[model samples]
Target chain A: MLDISVPAKVLFHLGPVPVTNAVVAAYVSTGVLVVIALLIRRSLSSEPGRLQAFMELLFEYIDNQLLQAFGDHTRARKFFPLIMTLLLFIAIANQLSVFPLIFQVLVEDKPLLRLATSDLSQTLTLGLVVVILSHIVALSMAPLKHIGNYFRIGAILAIRSPKDIGNALIEVFLGIMDLIGELSKIISISCRLFGNLFAGDVMVAVIVSLSAFTQFIVPMPFIFLGIFSGFVQALVFSLLSIQFIAGLVNTAAANKEARLNKGKQAALEQPATA
Target chain B: MTLVIRFTHFSTHMEAEAMKFLAAGLCMGLGAIGPALGEGFVAAKAMEAMGRNPSVADKMVPNMIVAMAICESTGIYSLVISLILLFVV
Candidate 1:
């Protein structure tokens, strides 16, 4: 009697495109977020009201988290919008998904609204976006160093004696591993969110179907857990994104600093030798 | 001879089903151990820090949670694999 599957049920075709219930649910959550944002913007005041104050508090809290992680004000500010967008969207979307009542409305014999993040495609896209953006940021910050990170061309070129060949080979292998690590980063991030949400859904469903009486009150704790974990996962996702991006930025900065130090050392030594 | 053959066929089919369930169960059970220990350690350290310095307790909570979630991801990966084995495979 209980149907559990990975793929979201497609509601109908929109011209040429097939629209799944998860997409519609995602749109609803996004709409809800946009409406709240618009309302807060409209009521903007120097003297903070309840909504404005709460919004400010939320922003400042996440900003503090980012500041703590990044340890640099400019870099934190640079990435704030992306991080904030991710946090708010995911938090709201995930929180909205916990209510089982949303799934009762049947369309074409399937649930009209399903948990959006539970869908692999959506979360994978989110992970891909975060990872790709981090690379883009790193590339923009230090193009040559970022490229050299994935390709050990410099290490290979630096090799002169036979003894250096082993080290060069190791560097090349490590570079390849770094590329694989990037791919795994996307998979881990996406799968973590999807598995948590899908498991929560399954747990609640199992609890509710145990008995007629159990369905009345037994699902409360599971739902609460779902809501709590939803917010936590959202926070984790954004924080992880910040950490990944900051790491790339730090690596680039370190590379530039080392290059500058090497140049300075060369200049000082050339004058001494001359 | 025919009856013996039928029983052998049925037993093999039953054995495959039993093995599937066993694999899924083992996957989840073993996978949960590392994350449980890691999360416990993270909490223990956070508690220790909070007890030492009450002022930073609020700050430590978010970091503690982030670390715990990171620890939990491996368990979730195993859960996903098990779920796939149980349902999709």
Candidate 2:
């Protein structure tokens, strides 16, 4: 029986920096993705071929999701490329386990390529990117208001009396909580993807090792489950990214609504006083 | 001295055996129950929703799958613990 626990490492050095199998796997996956993209791009026609049609279906599905998520068709179209790429990369990485060579050839002394999502570094990096991008998008759409979100700059700058000190304290505390929540988002997003993919890989390894007879058929059901799981994890990551962006947009909307309501109240009070 | 030493050794062996069994079997066996119930409940709810609006299965199924994965995490944790006990211990 092969030792599935050990990963095959392909080593390369740039200056003093040593690159390992995980890095190679990421590069290889990226290359594969590029090739797939090129193939889809080349195959496009006035009347769609089967491959083009299938690709279009997937694209349209993701495009619709982006529309629903951003609540603006123009914004959705702009962000679709990045979000769709993330979804595709994750989905492919998750399903890479099904490739027989991944286990047989890749599992020598060290893994040449472990599933990209299974690596903690990769998942965490991806999570951080998502969070950072969400924040950037929020800032771009509502510059002054979004800046105020993190520091409550408006509240701090507008203090008119000593009693406002209490409100400012509350705002500072809420700001701290918001910062912690963002950090927790990074941890949860990374851990959730890592835990699921790693557990599935471990399960299949153990199940196959139990008995040679069981190897052929016993792991089939779990493999099926893993495929379903791969798709879900991909969707969850993308949806969570969308949700974060949506929340920021909604917060800006809410701030606008509050200002409008306050303006109305001020207008009504003026007439009453008169 | 010999008699006391032998008694201590026997008790240690028995304790190890008990720990091995409890860690490997009991943790996972018990953990499976909650996930099973949770998955079934989720599936039932998802099915009801799908039945009401069959056209939305594409959206619904993906959401259901995400919900199921979260529910499955408990079971996965138990399995990880059990495997650790069986192999690493």
Candidate number achieving the greatest lDDT relative to the actual structure: 1
Model 2, position B66, has a per-residue lDDT of 74
Angstrom error at residue A161, model 1: 2.4
Which ranges in model 2 have alpha carbons more than 4 Å from their true place?
A1-10, A106-108, A150-172, A250-274, B1-38, B52-59, B70-89
lDDT of 1 at A82: 93
lDDT (Cα, tens digit) per residue for candidate 1, span A1-274: 5777788889999999999988998999999999999999999999999999988998998788789877889888988999999998889889875555788889878999888998888999999999999898778777899999989899999999999999999999999999999999999999999999999998888888888988978888988999999999999999899888888887877777788899999999998999
TM-score between candidate 2 and the true structure = 0.75
DockQ-based class of model 1: medium
By DockQ thresholds, what CAPRI class is model 2? acceptable
Which residue pairs overlap in candidate 2's backbone? A7-A110, A7-A111, A8-A110, A8-A111, A8-A112, A9-A110
Give the per-residue lDDT of model 2 (tens digit) for A153-257: 667777899999899879977887888898887877777787678768877888989887878889999988888888888888887777776778667666766
